[model samples]
Target: MDSHVFQAVAAAAAALLLFLTYHSLAFVAGKKLPKGTRLPPGPPGKPFVGNLFDIPPEHSWLKFKQWSDLYGPLFRLNIAGRENYVVSSEKIANDLLRERGNLYSSREQLPAAAELLGDNLRPLFLPYGSLWRRTRKLMHQLTMPSAATTYQPTQVLESTRLLDDLIRAPQDYQKWFARYSSSVIFRLGFGKTMQDEDVLRRIMDVNHSLERVASPGSYLVDTFPSLMHLPDALAPFKRELKQLHEAELGLFRELLDDVKKQMDQNVAPHCWERTFIEQQESYDLTTDQGAYVIGTLFEAGSGTTTAALQSFVLAMVHHPEWMSKIQQEVDEVVGTSRLPEFEDMPSLPTVRAVIKETMRWRPVTAGGLPHQLVKDDVYNGFFLPAGTNIHPNQWAIHREPSLYPDPEVFNPDRWLDPSFPTFKEPLTVHPNIQNYSCFGFGRRICPGQNIAERSLNILVARIAWACDISKAKDEHGNYVDVPLYDYVSGFNTHPKPFQFYLKARSPHHAIIVRSALEKETQSDPLAGK
Candidate 1:
């Protein structure tokens, strides 16, 4: 950790990366263009590195948006020699990523996430093809709208402890949120709760490493993929990745084997693992692939769900006015007697709007998952050659000034009130978060979208119904400030450590919350079945 030596090494690495980039640029961009077509205009980058230096060290999304404003909404950012097209306009994103998805459904090779960490088996990292299709189909069948409803009882049951955790240990609300999400995914994937502290820590660690590794520029190998070809003996850089990959797969195998043992005893609970085990042959999957499919589902849901819940808390603390409005709306729909249930979801428009607005306000994957073109394409006289990397930058797409007026402000009215341009009629249908751009676009939309939405719905509703959240206070009774942008960077992001306050709405609410946990064993009808 010598600062001077670290800086020197980093500078040298940057120089090397830049040196190889121009050569890559020559290979990728040297192809002939279609007649009467050209690439989209963008901010001019320097000779070799292109926009490498133009991008700042952190929050590159802001710089991308700034470029989108300077250039058109659909423009390119050439990093080193890579042809990255950033689509800020929702229309353009839909047109390219949705309407013409056939050609744009593939993904660029990711060194860390796709290859090193997952062996390209993780659904999120799988390119658009047969294996990707089979996995996506299986997950969709498990997590689709109607199918997602099957897990609501588990979501509701797990959330009882979440509410109790909030009432008792509000200072560790983030940990509780993490626990709630991880526990739900564990229950669904392996038919067990996340009570073992060490196992929970390992699951959390794997996901954090996943978010970190999946980030673009996390490894220079992603920039210069040749680094991935080094001999196993000489590739010291891959040691951690290899270990992480094995550890993750090992965790999945261990859990799946446990399920099999229970299955042999005829005591296994209903879970995705069991289901995959029963039907793996039909899907043409091996034993390991089955485990990975279930594990990938858990990996997809655990952290992002926690991040969404954390963002909800952040939104509540930062904008108490909107929070108050949601409280009032929830109070009117489901009185002060019991916790809000999924049945009340339809009537709680403001609550749903706040959740939608919360995600829009702060997307988990701010940078967005990069999509690759499988064939040459043209849009509006722009010749985007094959192999171009397209980023429907979630951060920029969510902040399109035309769609989200005063986008920086956390105003739920944009989704709730009729006058706002983003508002839609039939409050029951319009403000849905499942189809939001943040989830994704085209064939690559998040398979866990249904489950994430359901989890958020129940959790947000119950928390709003049972407790009040606000800024934490010191012994002197002074309120602390919550930083809006104090968020973790990477593909999947969440708030950095900050102070917050949580309390039951009243003694009655506290009683209900505590009593709910008291019935933990029999409370879930799905339990012990």
Candidate 2:
């Protein structure tokens, strides 16, 4: 053989040997570390990609149920080269989400989320650390039980507008609901009422943008994060996302700047932004922090409240009997002479049960936000590896027959026994009705739960008190049915626009509504006697 040929063969052998050596080293390292215990059940997946293509991009929740049923409560799923655990049972969810929450609080590595929002977003997305702690402190101080009382007058005023809108045009109920929710948050966050100023339009625009970006499958770059590193020429999605990122930033910053100016003038209205701005120094808050705090509160209040109201309306239309029942309760307690107040909520068991059933039947966030593990953890003898993306499929858990019998049906009776306990109480009080996962669980549970609960209760009670809700009909006058599961696909699940017929329950109710508006007119200086 020639000397040159021999040399080339030697070099090729050396390269092949190096490749094998590296592969062996990586295999041993993977074995040493615990992603999950070997022999645990998981769907058969392709090598390297690991079930990435097997799962549908949208409606991942359905896939979760299928796998959970096939593999049990705790099962392993591999994405790309990484492993994730799909937690479907309430027991496993509670164990990790609450019992051992500290280790389970960090977020999964989402490149789009990180790049777009940065750390300047809600405490919900913030890693389990100081940033989250600080934001929560500010929100808690403002939205806690006591502070919620101070905001009741605004809630009442805003809710009244909702009723007025419904009375004027019931077909626009969805928009009215959105407007009512946005107006409440605007009033609380910016200290201004949305009187024909298109609050819903502005909120819907931003929310639509957010919804587009939040879809797990919105951008293919998210699925294959390695693609994010590709050059701009090869990766057009980067430019698109960047454009969206800037647009959202501009929107948030514009709003933030107005609040900042209000602070500068020291004439800012009584709002959450003003509260945080005044104590910015004391709370160690930067402009970015304040922006996110305000942004998140607005996001939470607007989306969640709208969905809840939508659910409430949907329930009322579908089951007018419940509406009648609650209206009777409202009349019996607060009477037709006056509007129902927050204080009346405790005594109004039927109304409270209605709210519970609405939350149960159609959760705002069907699939709770994804949570990532920061470290390798073991639960019930199953190992969950570090970096494993976790989701407590709230829809599945809520629908579990074992937990809630006949979960598909909208029944308020389940929440109304003498021994039945509220979600506010732990299961030790009554194991039959575990806290609705509506507000979520663990440290990451919604901070605005108190305010949300109050706002929802008051609005629902008022609707039941004032309106007789029933299904709307087509031109042919056939009864229009609303599919219970039909909802807009987004980070938050809300029913699509649908019409409902509503009328004052009685002439007395109509008279009272007219009288309330006339009273407002009497108070206005422009109105003549």
Candidate 3:
């Protein structure tokens, strides 16, 4: 496939390098008679291999940023005949992916993740077409900013439970954060909490596999489409990934059947799945298609929220002073009488700023999803040929010094202080992550972003109010250093396991957490904000 990301496989060994391709093949898009216009400037690469060795297996964003620094935001790379354009400037991204979305909303075919493991039905990977439009239209009612509010009752309840989880099991805060995110999305999609150990394990296993396999050059077939044309006997990646696909689809079918039975018996809780299933015929989706959409929804929310929340914790360890400031604001606004609610979100600017910063500081989709341009286009007198893969480069765009000063520092004031370029007139609207490049660009942006922000908001606020996150201590009681930018490398990257101390700010705060959980469990879980 003419690809979208780094050819990381070549970076592993005396593998093919990309520098040899730069001299004659850099900007022409295979020479279709575009004589005058030149493609975006980029690093020179090897012949045939085309920047393969130059692109690292993990943290390719850093390399992209380095090139962005040299090439001034619009740069190009060719990996084994694939044309890749990394757009580090938010303005260029908006001009192309958003404003010209008609020609740029499609995604390159990810042979491994989108085809073999996903059966080519996953909405996230689908190119812009009838199927994608149908799925997006079906989900429009459920995922919009206004609609996400309906799930606040569940979000509030689980976020309260999240506070309890941190207070009781600080060592396992990551898992609790995972659970909180999973339960919220699971309930919204399937009308049940995520309690089945086997199901959770399988979900996580598939997520990890996708992250690895979906990477640009992880599989040879993804990097070189010709390899995919061979028979299954010749292509081991196909055979193995097919089995993995069966296991994943089986999981989706199981969850769909469970929801169906509950609906048949009139016992199902209120959820998007119940609505979706009842109208599947009208939505014109096959059984498999319906399942894929719902499963994608759940998968998107769970892992991303987990990663972002974990980043919040990591940020606190890096910069504890902001933690203190946010806690003070939460205390004054939320008070000790009850857990923080979504209503308090308006009053807590520091909390919002922290969440936004956490996302900007270490975006989950670090490399940003690849958007394929469908037609030739010119931007700022620079040519971008059709079939060019564009990456918004979240890691670089968020670090744009014009918008975020001292980008390396994990500072929340950049969002609050008006002197900063990123500051908006009204604090309420400026820090929103709705259209942030970290989420995605234009029509391909994440549909579940509203729900994601709400989860981060409540959970981050409650944790800030109830617990103090600090550097962990070793056996001898010395501080354990938490690396600032060290993260697991994948399509959706997160901080690696780190040591951190989490506990209630005071005994009274711990009581408030328990009491809040008890009251929520006893009362209507869907009560108003």
Candidate 4:
């Protein structure tokens, strides 16, 4: 053949190959529904890449909320041909994630989340099966409400340090919150307190990586898992994920090794790690499984607790009236002679209300972790296929105008109002309820809710009792502007670090805060002796 003919043939072959590759990249298993069945209403999409570009990479809950507003509470999105069903109402979420939990409790196996970052060992990403059940059982054994009291001394001790940190360097309040939250989780996971900021940074780094990888539409490979079959030389994302996996494994293993050493010396404090290890055989958990279980708990516990504390500060700075009311309630119940304790919780209804309001106002997990369906189901005449991703969007659910009047405002009075449909005891409510929706729902509801609430309650109560959280002032003595809705985007959202003025309420309060810290430093209160 002539040179011109050969070139034309080669070019045509390349064009055909490209077409096939593009078509293959968007392939997804088609769901065949029963006759006359229909999916929930959602925005229209194009062929092969349905709603692919429609899904935003960051702050998707906002987009989801907008869709819910337009398409009713239940809606469907077909992204890259994958089906995602979002639930925006408390009633629908409760009916599915709670009432029919067994059919909706499984998790999707995202490549970055389950295979690379966590080696399929993290319980949070585990599917609804024996492994998930075992891990959850182990978690319940350590974090049930009955088990929560055992960790109060640790929480109180760490919270005292948080109060001191606020008094010393109010501007770095975010770091103080992170430190306190991580310290508690570290002690719980490893039987040792986090001594340096480096560990917390490392933990945050892992969390950030996971958030990006696990989030829907973050990576093409996650959507079209066939891409994972590509060789390492061709897949750059996998290489990066491999590095993250190694780093996370190293950190978790080092922590576990330290706990094992302590256990060998019989000096290990009673903690989740020690307890899990001793009972591992009964749970049929491998060493790696045990380590990842504890590590994922730290991941789930620390970032959320830190985010909640940061939001609490924002709420107080934005709505000082509620803060004052809480402070007055705290003063009357506990006084300045001693910091507020767990036993004072019932008498300090305002403090409890503040905690509940903070969670509702600025949920850390705006869109709760996605739950996959185990079987095809119909709800109110709409067909939901098995393996659909279900997102119980807390942002939309919490802000439902019917349930919460003026939902955007930071008001705690709703909880106290008899006419309001608030959970009677927010702290004791099941995770599926409206008040506890921040934690999540169904079989996958956060097992650590009890301890997390305990931590938030103690810290919020103490901060209310001892400090005045207000907006910072400029050189001209004008209040510095703080946006009420400035938050970092992730699976676990947090107030983007902002300036706030946190001062001890009085010199006596300052002295008390310092004294408690000094005493805690001199002795290990977390030893639970």
TM-score for each candidate, following the candidate numbering: 0.94, 0.86, 0.93, 0.92
Candidate 2: segments with Cα more than 4 A from true spot? 1-29, 33-40, 117-122, 196-200, 418-435, 517-529
Error of 2 at 91 (Å): 2.4
Clashing pairs in 1: none
Error of 4 at 195 (Å): 1.1
Candidate 3's residue-wise lDDT over 352-455, tens digit each? 99999989989999899999999888888677778889999999999998888899888888889988888875775667777778889999988899999899
Sort order, lDDT high to low: 3, 1, 4, 2
Candidate 2 per-residue lDDT, tens place, 174-201, comes to 7788787787787787766666454446
Top candidate (lDDT) = 3
In each prediction, how many residue pairs overlap at the backbone (N, C-alpha, C within less than 3 A)?
Answer: 0, 0, 13, 0
Best by TM-score: 1
Residue-by-residue lDDT tens digits, candidate 4, 180-226: 88888888777777775677778889878877777766777777776
lDDT of candidate 4 at residue 97, scale 0 to 100: 96
User: Between which residue pairs do clashes occur in model 4?
Assistant: none
Error of 4 at 506 (Å): 1.0
Q: Alpha carbon lDDT of residue 525, candidate 1? A: 43
lDDT of 2 at 400: 74
Looking at candidate 3, what is the lDDT of residue 219? Answer: 90
lDDT per residue (tens digit) for residues 1-529 in model 1: 5788667766776666666776788876687888998889898888876787787756788888888888888898787777899888889888998999999899987787888998877777778888888887778877888888899888988898899888888888888998899988899888887778888877878888887887777786776775665556545768889899999988878989999999999988889988888888778777877788888889889888999888889889988887788889889998987888899898988888999998999998887887899998999999888888998878888888889999998888898887888888898766778678989898888889999988998899889889888898889999987888888787788899888888888999999888777776566644543
How well does candidate 3 score on lDDT at residue 102?
A: 94
Q: Each prediction's Cα lDDT score? A: 0.84, 0.72, 0.85, 0.83
Sequence-dependent TM-score of model 3: 0.93
